[model samples]
Target: MPVSTVSIPVGQWFTDDSGRWWFDSGSLALDFAYTGAIRVTVAPETLHAPDDLTGWMRERFPMPVGVARSRDLFDAVSLRDAIGRLALAAGRGEELRAADIDLVNLYAATPDIPPTLGGGSRQAGRSVQTVGQALSTIARDAVDCFGPANDGRVRICAGGCGIVYLDTSRAASRRWCSMQRCGNRAKVRAHRARKSGKVALTAA
Candidate 1:
């Protein structure tokens, strides 16, 4: 079967920094790469097939979804879009509609798949939970991003990649979601433009 969608930076969503469990871009990363596929199409695409959804969940959240079905795909897509809407609104400092918040709240209440503990001889173990719970937690994280303390720090990427991130920089002047990705691309484009302008001046 043909793969429906793939991700850039393949499966690099969750960042383990100094033994802390958090995304590098704050909670916004929960919806960053996955959510954009809801409205816009990426080059490799996001979640187009059930397998894609399963893989994304497995890689990003480190959960086993087994075989993802059509229904699971739909639910995943829906949740992603809801989170994205909230992130955008938060970044813009616009009050979110009651319905939007309700959507996320509903999913946050119940988990589709429960977790189970597995891993041999590690001194301790935990069971794997359902995928539904994993996804719900992701939504909850997105909601947390809208909290007062972090909301003001939220920023929509200026690179036009349709990603939102928490600007934790001391100066609070961060403009891109990832300096290695979006930031570098923006700089390269600007450099090229400046060079082009210089050439035009020489010609004139």
Candidate 2:
């Protein structure tokens, strides 16, 4: 059976320590082709432009691929460090936390969701070795080298696709920076899934 499509807003992203836009990862449709593919035919950059958030709500969008890492492409320490401290705390190794390590952002370009190839259940996901030291370590090192606060937050400003970290403290209650979209979406998905059997795995 084919899975139905569910489209949402695109989120913003940040430039890693190396200064490359890792662009938001959650809502980005990696497979968004006109033929109805999970991966989108359009370029990721089309919806996302690093630090260039001139778009607006539902207008251009600023959502992540899914609700997972939002920027799982960080393959370096500097870039990892660039991820907010809360992100680092949540991220496993230099990547997203154990919960979202294997999840690929599944949000779509349109208002539809494509079939997830591997399915959304990440119960089997295993922890992977990080690049160099942990993100926290790298962040600390950078702070020391820079001799000041470079500010652990990245700037991603896509009106609707953006997330503003309300609190980046050490608490575990830090879900999405905003509750209107990401957080609300999660709640809705869980409810819908519980009410129906069609939902196998959801990254909304």
Candidate 3:
């Protein structure tokens, strides 16, 4: 199974410039990486202000995160980029940069949000005291996913989407990030090409 700090909803989808919905990349770190342009063809800049960061936190985590500050936003963007680069490198079998590794380690060193019980429900939730804690949690998840034992499972979508994801299939043969997004598009294009070729041959 892919490493994750929380349950990934099957319908958790994000829209891009083309209005196509794309799902999570199977981990919180990779999801964060997707909030902005990394290696992906369509980049979405969702973290523009402190409120943007907090809103994203609320969407991703079941618990409430502390109010984000301007400084926190800056740090979050930096960490996000570093995580993105690391994930793409891992997926492409490229060498991980030392600076990016150090940046991730620095954020991961911070204390993470502690789990709390009794939040109007029996389910456990996290108590995030600060934005740094929330970021630390994401950085730690990146560490786990990019580690030697799990890095091999990282894969870049083959449909030219440029997104990276964990290949958790039984045979580890997953080629696209999401079937509804890239996979179906690829199938349609192949079918069109075949039909065009057949028409040309009949005319000739």
Candidate 4:
């Protein structure tokens, strides 16, 4: 039988870095690359390439990319980048600054998926905890493979990436990075509920 799924919650939402992660990791119009039909697996060397990072940045967080453009393809690269970077940093015990964390959070939040590779939380952290659980697995695995934070480098090297989706304050109670997509969705739902007077709302 197949392996059991991990739990993913909606509010279990995570931030990769800070601002970057806050944005829901935007994508482009022509994201055929993200279709489940594509068959690719994780390769260590290719993923670690500076080229990969550059290409990914251009693809998902392109200068032209924005919330309107946010799509599944963006999730593919971003989700991969996030988990991979975190795994690397965690493995080496690198101090993941905002930059580093942003990458991973993006990774976790993207990838709606063909069902094989981790596309992160579809439930946003609710459906049996599938998506959130996958991210947790990635983080936990990263820590197991990488190690504890080293000399606060996770904050420097990772830099804005680490804090992009996270709050910079002592409370640090931020998750997605923006109130646009998920947050707005929640608001819309609440507003609709108030208007319709629905006692219960379906999960997003």
Candidate 5:
């Protein structure tokens, strides 16, 4: 049976140290894309509304799923918390304690539901292993980021968005998550400050 498509709402995504598709926003305490698909919890007042979890999962991963269960959601939140801390530590060039690594690895090693042949048009069914796959992928990426080959590319955005990304720029000088987003906003603010200074000088 074809899974019904729900109206997947638009969400803001930012790359974190753990993965390239991490959801992020200044408005959201945590990315709804991650929280909704993984069923994680954020502040109650956060703007992340996970009304259409099925559609949300489809938009990101190929795993078939209905609404996420509460237990899975809790687990996702826990794993995400560890990922956030590890990413932050990497961004700051700080050491990661063994406990932090262990937490991430524990989630990463979650056994995936074996894919089985589905009747008719369904090639293989994910059952409910989507969450496991997602968590493991995050763990693998985190491991890579800590490796020497990619560690130098890790950077925390200076724009205060609290986002982390691998700087793939040729100059390795990429700062904010995007030149059009946080970077441009910072430039505009600086310009306004210069203008304000000039006006004050004239008045003086």
Candidate 6:
């Protein structure tokens, strides 16, 4: 079954140690991947408890999902790690691991929230009622993103943020995850470097 590609809004934010909030990856699966520590070494695990998972789902999905249990948290973290690994491989044009593929397939095979019609208004109907369904939806999106349909559009953030995002730009030249975050930082660093070089030339 072909999963319809869904565009997740760019509202989900993560705060780094410097207290700066960073935008999430554009896709649902990639956003879910952002919940875990991708490449940074310190403070890796973000989904610490069941409530954490519940909070994450509530923030992303339009409707409220049931409270996640311990088992749900465990499974969610496992799926998140698998998606991160597979996404990195897809972005780098490397062969994906069999275990990661099988795990994502297992979750994708589960039932997911379906779009529904109500009150004569068409809603995306992401009314996720359970943790399992939410995970399934994410896994299905991952399959769409990393599968042959992707055409190698996935890319890791060049700014060293370790975010794996689908390159949706027209030119496919996007390097940073968010312009306000990494892009702005890069610009500031370049400016400072130029200023320092000018100072050195004056001293010489």
**Per-prediction TM-score to the true structure, in the order listed:** 0.64, 0.23, 0.81, 0.25, 0.59, 0.80
Candidate number achieving the greatest TM-score relative to the actual structure = 3
> What C-alpha lDDT values do all the predictions have?
0.59, 0.29, 0.79, 0.33, 0.52, 0.78
RMSD of candidates 1 onward, in order: 9.2, 21.8, 3.2, 20.0, 8.8, 3.4
Task: Report the number of backbone clashes for model 2.
Answer: 35
Counting clashing residue pairs in each candidate, in order, gives: 17, 35, 0, 57, 1, 0
Cand. 4 Cα-lDDT: 0.33
**Per-residue lDDT of candidate 5, residues 53-155 (tens digit):** 3344455555565555555556556655665666567677898767877876775566533435557475566355465554454455455545576556666
Off by over 4 Å in 1: 1-24, 32-35, 38-45, 63-66, 111-126, 181-204
- Model 3 per-residue lDDT at 9: 38
Error of 5 at 78 (Å): 1.4
Candidate 6 residue lDDT tens string, 58-141: 887766678999999999999999988888888778999999999999999988766555665544354547989889888988
Q: Which stretches of model 6 miss by more than 4 angstroms?
A: 1-11, 41-43, 120-128, 191-204
lDDT of 2: 0.29
Off by over 4 Å in 3: 1-12, 37-41, 117-128, 193-204
Best by lDDT: 3
Which runs in model 4 stand beyond 4 Å of their true positions?
1-50, 53-164, 175-177, 198-204
Error of 4 at 92 (Å): 22
Q: Model 2 reaches what TM-score against the true structure?
A: 0.23
**Global CA lDDT of candidate 5, please?**
0.52
Better of 1 and 6 by TM-score: 6
lDDT of 4 at 149: 24
Candidate 2 per-residue lDDT over residues 161-192, each given as its tens digit? 33323222344244553454446667888888
